[model samples]
Target chain A: MERCRELVRPALVEAVGRLHPWTGEMAAYALGWADTAGNPDPGGSEGKGVRQALTVLGAEAVGADGRDAVPGAVAVELVHTFSLLHDDIMDADTLRRQRPAVWKAYGTGPAVLAGDALLAQAVTVLAEAPNPRAAAAVRHLCRTLNALVSGQAQDLRFEHRPWNGPGAVGPEQYRSMAEHKTGALLGSAIALGAILGGAPDETVTALERAGRHLGLAFQAVDDILGIWGDPAVTGKPTHGDLRQRKKTYPILTALADSGRAAHELAALLDSPQRIDGEAAGRAAALVEEAGGRAATRDEARRHLDTAHRTLRDVPLTRTAAQELDTLFTHLLDRTW
Target chain B: MERCRELVRPALVEAVGRLHPWTGEMAAYALGWADTAGNPDPGGSEGKGVRQALTVLGAEAVGADGRDAVPGAVAVELVHTFSLLHDDIMDADTLRRQRPAVWKAYGTGPAVLAGDALLAQAVTVLAEAPNPRAAAAVRHLCRTLNALVSGQAQDLRFEHRPWNGPGAVGPEQYRSMAEHKTGALLGSAIALGAILGGAPDETVTALERAGRHLGLAFQAVDDILGIWGDPAVTGKPTHGDLRQRKKTYPILTALADSGRAAHELAALLDSPQRIDGEAAGRAAALVEEAGGRAATRDEARRHLDTAHRTLRDVPLTRTAAQELDTLFTHLLDRTW
Candidate 1:
């Protein structure tokens, strides 16, 4: 991972820098560089740079040269950054990575433009690759990009009120949103690597599907941590999900259970900001007591199992499979 | 012109309706239909819709099936609407087309989302075209779309303060900004027409260049009217540009020529609101005295000439070329 990180950062910077010549400053800010003043401010500043790493790792795992994957690395990172910029604006959270969000910092006018530049450049840069295969990647990327935005719109709509009319968000609905928001991009990341490598179509599909499963597990874990993770570790406020009243899987499970704990959770949700420290602690305990936490864990584990199975079944070399295995397992096994 | 408007309005509405699966409220609002609350409170509101008409006309000029250009028409209109939504927000303009702007009516968040949705659906709908040609349209439209945003950024940046520094914004900078702000999409409108009509590359290039020039002429005439036209005639405020203090070509030209009038003009520009109606009238007279309006007209005429030249060069029936010539001439010939 460290080796991959070192290889991809400069390229990520180059790609983002080359993105919007007019709006490039906003793109730079998207990468956690500055606040348009060129001041070195840290606000969880650097992205995990995980998407670029995913591209390179996907390439290496498929027995393709890492150098061949550079374009794909740049492409994936551009999509990822654009998604973050736009989503931050749509969510209206005002803070991203603990910094004033782009929309908040420069105002929504420029933040949206900055995000627009990223998406436009992603296609432009991909078109630069002299491979006919690049067209397929571009096509798939556009579809995924559209899905990402659609999912976000749907998710934002969910926040306006209790969706499905007074019931917890169902697990299937959670999966659908996760698929569009997180898994679609992840699948595109893996698919990009395979197509750039000239891997067979079947293997490409498997890797993409594996990525989807991994993304689902990743988000499920994220949801669990959103409610219960320590701020010291998560860098997010305690009960941040409760604060937003986000309908993550665990909370949904608790709400749908229709028991004493469920009733208490509903009461907490009805009164915005009513979930105080003790109330939050009690709510978390009730959620776990009502099997919500366990249910979420089981769903995540199921997806992780599917990802591993797909990785094994994908018709790639043993080494390729092993690299993917390493990445997915580590993603699922994160403790904080 | 009535026939063109008839062809464009319903088609534009239907295309935008396919975008978010939501009701046609935003599109309707933009189209000057129902109000923000979905009431049928419409008597006035309509943009030039010139971009959409151009797409259809460009296709017709090729003697190709006009329906083939529908995706391009929809895509360009949506991109144009997105720009209007964001532009109104950035400009802090309260109204558009004698009605509330999208941001004003829908609130900032939904207006932004609506714009984002429009843009996303623009790409998605283009991608959905039944041929690879539609994909190419997507490719060109995305680039055009980016440039549009960049242009808006430049326009917004310039709005923050005066361009009191060096260089005559000249024909070149104005041309560049106009091309990005409006021309590229018009060019896309034409090129996509040629593509959808299966016109050859040379013809497409000619159409595109023609569209660029037409766009410049369009904006120049707009800038001219923004200041000089009667409010009753133009259906906008007289000296609107002066009120906006827009550093358009005429103003820039006036500013570039040094004199007492130029100094007074600059003073009025520095504090546009402080300038009385008499002072504003004096400023416009001084701008004319400084050869501002004449220089702008000359530039507009130059572009119109180039646009006609490109139209003549393209391999088409003389009648089709003449039709385009008439359209360009009418656009440049707008009185108010």
Candidate 2:
């Protein structure tokens, strides 16, 4: 993972720097490369670079050199950051990676433009690829972008749905959102690697399927951690999604369950009062009591199993396949 | 113009409808294709498809069928609307085409996402072009997008600069902003048509140059009209830009000129009081007295001449070149 991050970081930096200086500064700040003053911030942390690693891993899985997928990786990461910049504003998240979010630091206008520039840069980078596969890469990336935006729109609307009314969010709706919001990019990342590596269409489709399953599992785990993980490890408050009344998988699962705990959890969420820490804790306990936590964990495990099963049929070398197996297992096992 | 709008409107509708339903609805509203309830609003006027017409005209100038450039035309128009959606938000303008802006009708979140989806869709539309020229089209459009974003960033930053401070806006800076903000897309519109039509590199370059001059003239005329245009025809309040203290071409030009009226206008703008109707009227008079209005009009004519001169050397057929000349002249002569 570290090696992949190192591989993709320079290209990402140079790609962002190609934007207009004003937007470039904001992009650099959002990407954790430089501070607001345009100076490199060595202490700032870039996130796990999971998407780029997956691109490389997907290429390697197709028996192609991973370096061939660097453009694809860079494009995926840019799109991811683009979404992050805009999502942070939509969600009113004031901090990212323990620093002021781009919108908070530079004001909403610049942050929005930075996101726009980054997204345009993503397509530009792919179009500049020195191969015929560039066209296919662009097409796939655009589809992914459409899905990401759609998912985000749906997620925003979901927030306003009645807590327990007929139009309330359900596990199915949450899973659909997760698929569009999270799965689209991951699937695109894997498919990009395969297409860029000159893999067959069948192989690209299979890789995309595996990526979708992996994304579902990844998001499910993230939802669980949002409510249950340690703040120190998760970088989010315990029951954070619950306190905010986010219709995450666990909360929706609990809402759907037919039991006293489910009713109580719904009542707590539907209340007009803000959920303070104590109420958040009680809400978490109610979710657990309604079997929501276990259900979410089981759902994640099911998706992980599907990913493994799908990969088993892929024609990867033994070494590459084993690496993927280990990586998937490790990812689902992380406490954060 | 009506014939061209008829030609492009269906495809534009189809293109936006391809987005997710929610974003599609917002996009439709933003584009004036539909109302808030997703019904076609007959009274809602779609802006003249000027960019698309330029694109088709560009293709015809290169001896290609105008229909051949529809995809490119669609891409350019999508990008134009995409910038409009975001710019309306940044400018905090509640109205567009005499209707409430997208961000005003729908909340900012959906408006932003709709803009994003439209941009991605623009790229996707280009990538789907059957010809291999699609890649070049995407690249040019991306460059145009970068310029548009940069221009917008500059425009936003210009708003906060002191009227006569060290960082105050000047004519050159304002012209650069106009070139990027308005010129880039127009230039891209022509270039995309040429590229899509399989025009030689030289032809594409000439068309781009012509487009840039036209853009500069377009914006300069827009600035002049903003203050002096008849409200009954222009559909904007008298001195609307002045009321908002927008550093438009005329204002910036007047600021840079050395004269008594220039200093007085600067002081009036620098004052803490808002420019209401009386002050806006006074400011307009002072700007004219400072030679700002005349200068802006002269600048527009100069760029119009440049565009005509550049087109004179291009290899377009007599009919097509004459068509472009008449169109450019007609456009610059419009009162509203």
Candidate 3:
């Protein structure tokens, strides 16, 4: 992961440097390289670079140098950051990476333009890459963007749906939304790496499938953390998703159960009163009583198993495969 | 132009149809195919399709059928629509095509997602096009997106600068912003059409230059209309830009002159009070007295002449060239 970050950092910086100076500063701030005041961050509070690691590992697994996938890594990271910037506004998320969100630091208008600049830079970087598969990479990125937008639309629409009645969000719907919202980009990262590394179509497809499964596992874990993780560890308040009435995996699973606890939780959620701290605590207990916690954990484990099986089935360089296994385990085995 | 619209309409509709139902509805609304209720608009308050016309004409001028550039035309129109939707949110403009802007009708978050969906679709449409130069076309579109974002950033930044100071926006800066915000896509529309039609690089470059000049001319005329045109004709309130304190061409030109009228106009604009109807009327007279009106007209004519000269020098199909000339004249000669 560190190696991947090193390979991607310079190119990502250069790509963002092409934006208008005002927006470029906002992009840098959003990426955690700079603070709101445009001062360089000595602590280097950048992202975990999981997508970058996936891209680099996918390339190495295909018997190519990790550096060969640097462009893909940078492109995926840019797209991820772009989505974060825009999503902060859409979701009204006040904080990101333990700091005020881009829209909060700058105004909504500037944040929107900054996000746009990053997205454009993502496409431009891919299109200008010297790799022979650059065109296919751009196509894959565009398709991923389409999926991301669709997922966001679904998530927003889910906000207005009934809590438990006719229009209630179901497990299948939640999975579909999560797959589009989270899986598409992860899948594209691996696929882009493999494609740019000259992997066969079958290999790329298999790797992408594995990446999708990993994404589902990741989202399941994130939903768990959203409700119960330590604030210091997660960089978010406990029950944040519940407060927002987000249709996350655990909540949807809890709602799917037919039980007294499920009905009580539904009634609580459907109430006109805001989900205050005490209500959120009670709701969290009710969710657990309805077997939401166990179900969510089981779902995460299942996806992780499937991802492992998929990875095992694919032919990859021996050392790189081991490294990928370690990375997956590190990412999904988080207590927070 | 009608022929170009005919070729592009179905493809454009189909491209937008690929978005999630909720955002697709908003995208349709933004494109003027639907109203606030998501019902189809019988009046079809669609844009003039000038970019689409330029694209098809560019193809024809390079000896290809207009139909050959449908993908390029559709891509440009989608990109243009995307910009309008986002720009309305950034500018807080409530109206588009005599209807509520997408953000006004669907909320800011939905509008942002809808704009994003259209942008993704634009790239996807170009990438999936059957044209041999589709890859080049995608690259051109991405570069144009970068320019558009930069232009928007510059425009937003201009709003914060002092009206008259070292950091004040100059005519050169305005021209650069206008070229990026308006000319980049227009130039790309023509360039993509030519490239997709397999025109030589030199011809594509020449055609793009002509398109840029036309874009500048178009923007100058729009600036004139923004300040002086009838609301019934322009589909906007009189002095709409002035009311917003927008650094438009006329206002900037008027402020640049060394004269009593210029100083008076500057003082009026510098005041904290909002420019109401009467003040806008007085400011209009001051602009004309300061030579801004004449200078702006002269600027438009100069760009138009340059565009015409570029077109005359280019080697093009005779009938197609004549058709393009007519299209340019018709577009630039608008009274509104």
- B1-336 in candidate 1: lDDT tens per residue? 456567656656666665544324676677666677666765656666667667777777888866777778777877777778877877788878777788777677667667766776677667676766765676677678777877777676666655455633544666677888977887887788778777777888899999988888778888899889878777777677876677787888877777777777777776637555777688789888877899889878888899988888777755656777787887787773
Ranked candidates, highest DockQ first: 3, 2, 1
Interface RMSD of 1: 2.7
Global local distance difference test of model 3: 0.89
State the lDDT at A77 in candidate 2.
92
> DockQ of candidates 1 onward, in order?
0.43, 0.77, 0.88
Write the residue-wise lDDT of candidate 2 on A309-329 in tens digits: 988988986776777777778
Comparing 1 and 3 on TM-score, the stronger one:
3
lDDT, candidate 1, residue B191?
A: 84
lDDT of 1 at A295: 88
TM-score of model 3's chain A, to 2 decimals?
0.98
How would you encode candidate 2's per-residue C-alpha lDDT over B1-336 as one tens digit per residue? 566667777778789879889899988887777899999998678887889988888888899877778888899889999999998888888888888989899888778898999998999888888876888888888889888988998898888788896888888999999999998888898899889889999999999999999999999999998999888778889999999888998988888888999999999998999999999999999999988998999999999999999999888967777877888888788773
Q: In model 3, where do residues sit more than 4 Å from their true spots?
A: none
What TM-score would each prediction reach against the true structure? 0.91, 0.96, 0.98
Over the full model, what C-alpha lDDT does candidate 2 score relative to the true structure? 0.88
Error of 1 at B203 (Å): 2.8
lDDT of 1 at A102: 82
